[model samples]
Target: MMNNGADLEQCKRLIETSLGWGDAATWTNEDFDTLSDRIFEKTSVRLSISTLKRIWGKVRYDSSPTTATLNALARYAGFEGWRDFMATTQPPAKPSPAHEAPPAPQKSPTRRFITPLIIITITFAVLISFISARIIHPPAANLPLRFDHRATSDELPNSVVFDYDATPMHPKTVMIQQAWDPKRREKVDPYGKQHTSIYYYPGYFRSKLIVDGELKMQSDVFIPTKGWKAIIIGDPLPIYLSAAETTLDSGRLSINAATLQAKTGSPVFNSKWTGFFDVHQFAGISGDHFLLRTTVRNTSTVEQCLCRNVSITVMGKLSAIIFPLTDRGCISDIGLYTGFTGVSGKDHDLSAFGCDFSQWQQIVCAQKDQTLDMWLNGRLIYTKPGNRSIGDIVGIRIGFEGTGEIKEATLQGGGVPQDLLKQP
Candidate 1:
């Protein structure tokens, strides 16, 4: 195929086939958008929705797509680049009917092909009916699923491979959920033996192996003891901070507004704001029995309709306790998950969790057996039963949605509350 006319047409055909478009004329904007998203997920580079539309001939105008865009699509399709894809997958050769001659019959048509044709039709019908029957009456009761997973390494940017047996049930609907994020959910063939995924950050993660929307098996993955890492989310990218950039004053790891602005080149009052602090010395902790004590204060003003919000996450191997703090009137969207059923601000009204966040306030989270309690300034504010292990505590993460200050923090395995009135 030449680059001028037929080559571009061939590229369009390849994209359409890769996207499973039955008919090119019926391709919708949403379909192109899905293609763009899939491409970005597989490769880090994102192609604009408009660029995809033009490539698919959904919109008018175009010089050839830039080399970068072509390379991205090629990488998305598992090739080295646009040139590589073209070199490996050549366009189909067209037939020249004008140069062909009529064939002479060697035998009677009915005698040679009629009997075989009838047999082939019957076999096809039987296969379709068998498939239809399976669809109509799907698997009942859970499949005898055996699931296991292990990581290639127990460090940052680790890859974990999950091995499972769910082939006895519906093979098409088997999926592996890597984390709480919907984007982490991946569909796998039930008949397939294994699936692998990589963890970009360190924490306790509960991975689920699901069959037909039902959880067949669940496991906890803990990436342990990587020291404290701090990050500030810069939308699609994250700005990482070194230990030198942060200070330890008293007992608190200090990250003030000035530090954030200098590192990110932007103020903390922007629409999208995030500051993360993680420590990885919690190998012996569990969500079922642990104590966390901290006092946080936000120096930024709450005058701009946004409260000084700070979140503390005690991450366990299979679950986490998240507390989002804001002003007395703002809402809290905290969560605790053990196999998809735990506490979340969406289901629990957290208006009661709000307080004066501008001043330093004592915060405590503790769990004893199946009971979990939260206390603010020695006053028990929230209590919830049905406490289950989210997983073994691998670490803790403290995040700020705006400019905030950490006065002091401590974690104890268990027992009576540490006296906040007594300075260490």
Candidate 2:
């Protein structure tokens, strides 16, 4: 059996491979942040960016990760837990042959000594040659780089065609990252002029070009939905809802519990979520300074979904603003995320976001200059400073643990008003 250290290392490697994000050495701070978010989304366990960085050796920490952390990592990798992962990773013992071959003769002491000496000399020579070659030919620098993209369509599952010029850095592999998540990165031929990547969801994305492990250039790739789209979040792929499957009437948009159960093929809504997305380019709404007002409530009456959680997300070009709400007693499980920072209820007092979801509740989020404020039921509950600029607001998403309804939604900025329920 492998030691604890070896097993941990193996687990890290498997996570990296499953993520498909190039190499961990080339990952940036934002990559780690994205990793933490993805892990929470899949496991409902939050691992801070600092913790993730330490696990990947990006930070200096003397102690090993806690058991809870290891279990979370294993679950993110599709295992039952750390113990289950270890059981599967252990190598099976090999059986000995019934009739073993007789031993040959032993080598002389002088031959053994000579053999080792010769091998050492050859290894030393090869190491010297490799070092000398690297010194003689260093990587090229300051080449004129160009990266840009064009979306093939204005809908989900849209493929974007990228036009790049990296011929000056030939022989070096180039990477095109679809968004902030490094897992979306893909290698392209250095000599090729174009590359294509498909986006499974609609949102504002920043595409980047990397060469020699350095960022060369980046461009914006915006894929807008044709209209409001409903979906049930699923593993590997989400179950999309047709327009006929949703109810958009009487100035509200909603999905019933039966529809969610039918789409997910599950009776219990423990972690199942249903979302409505209105993704498009909001011309005058800047993510840094805007007001998003919406009336929402959880409609799940299932016994298993006691938390009755719901979240509102404003998708931006650089990052997003996610505000969550839950039943008063389940406040510890909610979290708030601004583009640049995040706060969890487990560590902070987020009781203001807790309320009764049996009736409609109005939530308002406003960002001005460097401050962000949140209000529930027309009462200001949370205020935070140091809000970073996240570029233009491109889309909005509302998610519920099981089922929910949006009575009315509006986004206002730059002296313009947008009705989120109405199509452009």
Quote model 1's TM-score.
0.55
- Give the alpha carbon lDDT tens digit for every residue of 121-223 in model 2: 9999999998986666444464566788888876677888999988766657788888866667798888899999988777788788977555678898887
Put down candidate 1 lDDT per residue, 1-424, tens digits, no spaces.
2457565566667766776879977865556656765676556578977788787777896587888988887776667888888887877566689966578767688767987888999999999998997777556454466788999996556799898888766467788988655467899877899999877666766687867655567887666545566666654556666666655646455566777677766664644354544646565666777888888776666653276667787776555677667777566544443322445576678776687865687888888677777777777777767766655666777777656667766776773365732533
Which candidate number maximizes TM-score? 2
Q: Provide the RMSD of all predictions against the true structure, rounded to 1 decimal.
A: 14.8, 11.0
Cα displacement (angstroms), candidate 1, residue 254, comes to 3.0
Error of 1 at 314 (Å): 2.3
Give the Cα lDDT of each candidate. 0.69, 0.82
Worst 10 residues of 2 by lDDT: 414-423
